[model samples]
Target: MTGNLWTAREIAQQPDVWRTLATSLDADKPRIDAFLAPLLAKEDLRIVLTGAGTSAFAGQILAPGLSRTLRRRIDAVATTDLVSNPREYLAEDVPTLLVSFARSGDSPESLAAVELAEEVLSECHHLVLTCNPDGQLYRNTAGEHSLALLMPEGTNDRGFAMTSSVTSMMLAALTVLGANPDVTLLADVAADALPDLAKRARVLAEDGADRFVYLGSGPLTGLARESALKLLELTAGRVVSYFDSSLGFRHGPKSVLNPATVALVYLSNDPYTRRYDLDIARELRADLPEGQVITIGCRDDAEEETWSFPGLGHLPDATVAPVLLLAAQHVALATSRALGLDPDNPFPGHEVNRVVKGVTIHALDE
Candidate 1:
């Protein structure tokens, strides 16, 4: 309960930050329209959402929903992958719009991916979504074919893990890419859910669950990845974590479950997807009753064990995913505090970094 705990403040302030992002985007709608209108109109335009680490996960969360809404090919490729193998993902003949999501925007992969795209693609446009306006990706991407949108101030999280930063960038991408652009609604639902969610998370953290598994369906699977990373990062690797699709968990990943495990399931609001999520949760409860199982959903009655957000049932999986994001963050923060680690800089030895360091970028031609 310290104001100096940047991670806790960043996590708690997300609802309001989300609202402010919505309002700011609304005010700049005309500019957004101008920026996107022509690019969207292009025939066979390939939209590639690229980033590293937590930022890369944003693309994974948004691509499926955005591709469906826009009726175009939108792919989520990690900048790490793109940087390593530019020739595989980028094409010179095809027009490309690379949307880069970065918190600090200075990661080696961020700029390297852009450079590789320029080298290989004849026609390339960049849409940079970053929390830091002054970071390299934002400052250097101003040109005829590139536009960088910085998240409202304070989203650039000072914490070791990206709590507010990733969620805000994901929301910004959702807003601009036309995938359920109701930020106000998402923020409202998140606000409504946080009080009860925080209480549940604290109990879970204090309950001595040292192993965690996060499961989700479709776009929520991206959330699963982020959730796992948040716990791992915040706990400074003290907590072993895994993420998988709800159904996929049984294939092999379920072996991670035990008396010490906490299974966090993010259920999709979609009727079809919810079935798989519920089934997995039920199976986990039946098989590993000693392990704690937590399922988050929008419906009031799916199974006996679920955290229901009844007001948010009407929102799509992509829109409602952010609500569950807060739940995972709270859990991670609580666990970090429980473990007596500084969530702000969980790894002081610099094995990982706030902005990555010590990577030697190689020439693609070499």
Candidate 2:
């Protein structure tokens, strides 16, 4: 464990934490099935995955892939959005299952989202996945219509950014929602890949880029957002960070590239999407010849410009996203050190918080 900087240690320990969460969830399958069976059996059921910030990105990462696997509609709506305009995102007639993913379980929007769902929808159920058992969402949201799932110990990260907590919650959602969720294979990949990934991130961080851009396609786009946020949070906004879909990058965001910028592209395993990602990577390389463009994927012939994930060929984007997230977390931590910022508390003046503050929930007029 690194002294003072718990972020690096927490990020490095995520693979094992994910494994523990998988095992725990697997053991509780009967209960999970019982809670979800009725809601799933409903012919017209709608599922909304909600959270704040990185937790919200967990839903964003899972919704696209999980929808394909579950053969149902699963939408990712942020708690911030739901809190402000519950009428817009939440339906009154539809039987909805609001899956809440919270790291601390204490975020105001977490509880408010659940309350708003109860008020707006005739039939609503909750599948609360959080790191903190003591959190309001975990304590109050469980009942006949809801079930709360807690991650294994030590996942409640104490740092300014979420490393293990978000990944664990994301993996738990996959295990519970996936059709043939193979936790063992996902856990195995994380354990085997993280050591080298951390090293790669350290080397990249040592290279010292002033601007960072992370690009991904499909489900990886949400991960790009999370990765960019990690850098922005850990560096205390010192490193200018940006993220978008690889295709969307070419529109206008590509201007962020410079000699001191690090362009990281997360290549999709799907051949069709990978084409676009590769095309953009080449363009980024050509556009900023002096800047560093690192491709993170399992490309067989990656040349000299990639951080390859060997033996992880053809893994679904959902499974591979978590590993890439680990790579991003390491990069954020290293970049924080490069800029002489504290990974634990980047801003001593209390600009940002582990849990956001100063938000007052108002009545949503029916």
lDDT values of the candidates?
Answer: 0.86, 0.85
Report residue 115 deviation for candidate 2 (angstroms): 0.3
Question: Which residue pairs show collisions in model 2?
Answer: none
List model 1 lDDT by residue over 278-348, tens digit each: 89988888866654788887776545446766677767787777777888898898899889889898887
- Give a tens-digit lDDT track for model 2, residues 1-366: 444368877877876787788778878999999888878888799999999999999899989898887888889999999999998897547999999999889889998999989998888889999999888888897579989999988888988899889888888888787545555666676777777876777788887777989999989999999999999999999889999999999898878777778888999888898889889998888877554888888655655337876556567787667777878888898888877888998988999999999899998884
What is the clash count for each candidate, in the order shown? 0, 0
Q: Report the Cα RMSD per candidate.
A: 1.7, 1.8
**TM-score against truth, every candidate:** 0.96, 0.95
**Worst 10 contiguous positions by lDDT, candidate 2:** 298-307
Give, for candidate 1, the lowest lDDT window spanning 10 residues: 300-309
